[model samples]
Target: MANNFLRRVDLIFDQDCNFKDVLKSTYQRSNDDIINELLESGLKGRGGAGFPTALKWKFTSEQADVEKYIVCNADEGEPGTFKDREILFKVPLKVFGGMAICAKVINAKEGFLYLRGEYRFLLPELEKQLAQFQSILDELKIDFHIKIIMGSGAYICGEESALFESMEGGRGEPRNKPPYPTVSGFRKKPTVINNVETLVYSFMIFRYGAHKFKELGTADSRGSKVFSVSGDTPKPGIYELELGMTVEQFVEEFGDGDTKAVQVGGASGFCVPRKRFKDTIIGFEGVPTGGSMMLFNSSRSMYNVLHNYLEFFEEESCGQCTPCRVGCQQLKLGIEAVKRGERHATYLEQLQKLAQTMKITAKCGLGQSVANSFFSIVENFKEEMIY
Candidate 1:
């Protein structure tokens, strides 16, 4: 009930002035100061991983590499998620300012916003706004620059390494991690990959100071997050909520009638039955903060929903690795078998084991999290899976 950064969305629209200008004026500190403030604030990545943002920047900043890069992962291919799209269209300048600040902090000369291919309609509009921002930067003599790279709509590219490969004009398949993007990303330079919402918050953190930013959200999860609620929700758009808001409150506010379950964090995120929703809260502390929530009512068929999700994964896989390519194929086959009442209980057990193995052995996050939706839905709603 208390208003914090969650309600800033309303303020942004209600106030007639430019939100970018307000942010620039309010948070325009030197790069060093901004980085220090962010470190103190304990801001973690709002994207799926929830890595500490300050530590990520510190790693890149301290690295002895000559070339450094910052990338905004705007490739929002996760089903039921559209928060990044809204930010790109509604608050383009803030996204730009955040990237500029990130570049300055890491002393990176260049940045890129890797947008999904489906966002073709927004490209021209983004280009126009970007040009306007460029003029302002030129007048101000800022040395940093950003290019908008369009993705081929591959869900795998949402993974950082895959995004890097796509930027290099190759197929959008994921690469091996450990040498990670921080040490060797984007043409073999140290790079920082952040979500669109995470970068947008950077401008706010830089402007308002980290301590003030910390004042809003929970202790561990320290910020507000934007969730794109779809499916059975009545107001099925974006809602900015504090990190720790319970799922019950979220569902009651926007849920359609007779809500049965909710999927937090997107296609790769877990599904919670109505009973679990009451206890769960939004944030990286417990539940994931992947920025997508699809509510389901009793009227909705769990099998159909999961089938749709699996179909998405089957089509979007980059097919570079055997586990992902073959595993996803097997999963799809298993789903079809179950649907047709041809799968034995033993086959279902095998699918579960395969899901676990894929989580641990997959080449990247795509293969790792791919089975999440299936496993969660099946485990929680076993009754629905049977004829």
Candidate 2:
């Protein structure tokens, strides 16, 4: 088993033999065998939501709908999440292999990789890689085919339902629940939507067997995750590190000595002040992330950070629901009012209360998760907002 220390693993990008070999062997296994292996491995989605990948596959496979689809959520539009783009650019074969595995398990013949509009530059090479990957699929006689779909640059599309809407030629907005992607997705059929990194991990798990991954992280946060580290860090880039490590340990490795706070997960993620670094674990048992870690030194302003996040949510909010639409607008305005000495510092509490309400009343994760960053910042750095 793995401990809480940050261990840099060579699982994801480590390549040895041809990827087709891995696919050839994986395709040999029964669906039950593969799903059982994935279940035992405890692999979860790397897309921050952390749903069990095995259950997603099992659920989709169990569904009676033969006209199912597999979706690779390449809409990496989160504020600080760029690892998926890097994965798609560097090792697209692993992504395709993972999709093919899922397709076999679910008995689907077609899939789509919802590419972010901002990443239009990667299209040409990505298509080139896709051709090669498809050739391998043909050689292996796997009927599964993967296609790339373009996104119109909406951050909400990172949400599965919203991405489905965009794919179906509708406006990029979140639909209501009770009809999740697994049961009704991508043309109202069963769909297994996996993140770009999650798919790579799936491919890696099947390539290296389940226990190799299951032995990496703590029980709840099994396996290593790739993080997109940015802001104030000397070594800001994509890193594949073990989970269950403290923010303090992460800072020791990636942060400057003057680091004041670390934002785990992107703008929507919780902000940890310097004082709380040691206590904060970067995993599901602590602060679950979609693999974005941002460091801020004492020189950086917490108020500005909060303001910037609020502005992001306000601009990104689909405006479908009143709480997110109004909450994002007011939170940004409310923080600004206090900063400008127009409102009493007590008004900060009101903003926090509103954030809490939005967490409950808002329709989707975009609206619900605002309170994660909002309250964490205001509570830890109240003085920043007042003066």
Candidate 3:
């Protein structure tokens, strides 16, 4: 454990007791009380967006849909992030219990665990766990049931709207906003979709009172965060820490001595170089992460990092909008062109502007977030990017 690392709520790893009875007893509480407790805890979505979990539940629960859903986004495809796979493999019942709790709150009869295609090998065991949970729910006389679906390994499916599209038997492309998922989602019904970690926390918040959950982390980012720390680090694995630690603290604990930069929150997340480590916080107030903390040392090339991310975006972009489709290719080629001396070093300014346009007009988060690391790496590591 790193400095200031506190693990109070245990849902997945190192859990001793079965949580089924706890979940069964929770139904005695009113939906309003549960949602209110969640709101008071200041719990945010662990799925990168950091949206308030209580608000999403309240929105879907208040909707007038006959059939509602609770979709657990287990498609942990973000590069260098694999914490969900461990949670699904080890303690899937907690996840299902969390989902069943949500279904009870929102009056949802059905729920789906959208497992990543890469985790297909864990399906048999996950199904077995779900069956066991289903039996528990049946014993409790809860009308809700859960089914598992596997994704086709698209990185874009990690996005909430795109995940919905994939769940609906269509290509995993993000839908436009305004009629957000709470209003109409998952076969055009009111739905509440939460990341695997978020749902687990929901169960934890219920188990331990909201006040206890609020004791850890900063004001905005309350509670613990499970980080999938990898790359250039001495110890690369999942570590749960109280949310408001600085990047410097994280690096000191996990990073190699030669660490130069840390990409907080995977490729789409911000790039925090060593210079800003002390000033940068790791929680929602500073650079909020979705469980990916990739440390890079002096040996790693910033240009290659940006190039790899751009390549991912170019291949993963749905290409529904011109900004994301063309901007990704342009950014990838722009960096390559500079490296090849085909384009002048000053051309990076123009490329930055192109990236800015993509942030504004791109259809989904996949395209908009490309500018985050792209501009950060290009601007900070210009010397390394160009000759």
Best by lDDT: 2
| Candidate 2: clashing pairs of residues | none
lDDT of 1 at 171: 84
Best by TM-score: 2
lDDT of 2 by residue, 100-194 (tens): 99999999999999999999999999999999989988888889888899998789999999999999999888989978888999999999999
1 or 3: which has the higher TM-score?
3
- Please write out the lDDT profile of model 1 over residues 1-387, one tens digit for every residue: 443323433311122445446445534566567677888887788778999887788789888988899999999888888988988888888788778878877889898999999998899999998898888777667777889999876788888988899899888877777898889899979999999888877777665567766776788787677888898877887877667777777777777768998888887888888888778867765678578888899998898888887777778878887777788889878877876789864677788888888898888887888778878888887767766
| Cα error, candidate 2, residue 289 (Å) | 0.8
- Candidate 1: TM-score? 0.93
**Model 1 misplaced regions, further than 4 Å:** 1-31
Q: Estimate each model's TM-score.
A: 0.93, 0.98, 0.97
What do the candidate models score in CA lDDT, each in turn?
Answer: 0.80, 0.92, 0.88
Ranking by lDDT: 2, 3, 1
Off by more than 4 A, model 2: 1-4
> What is the TM-score of candidate 2?
0.98
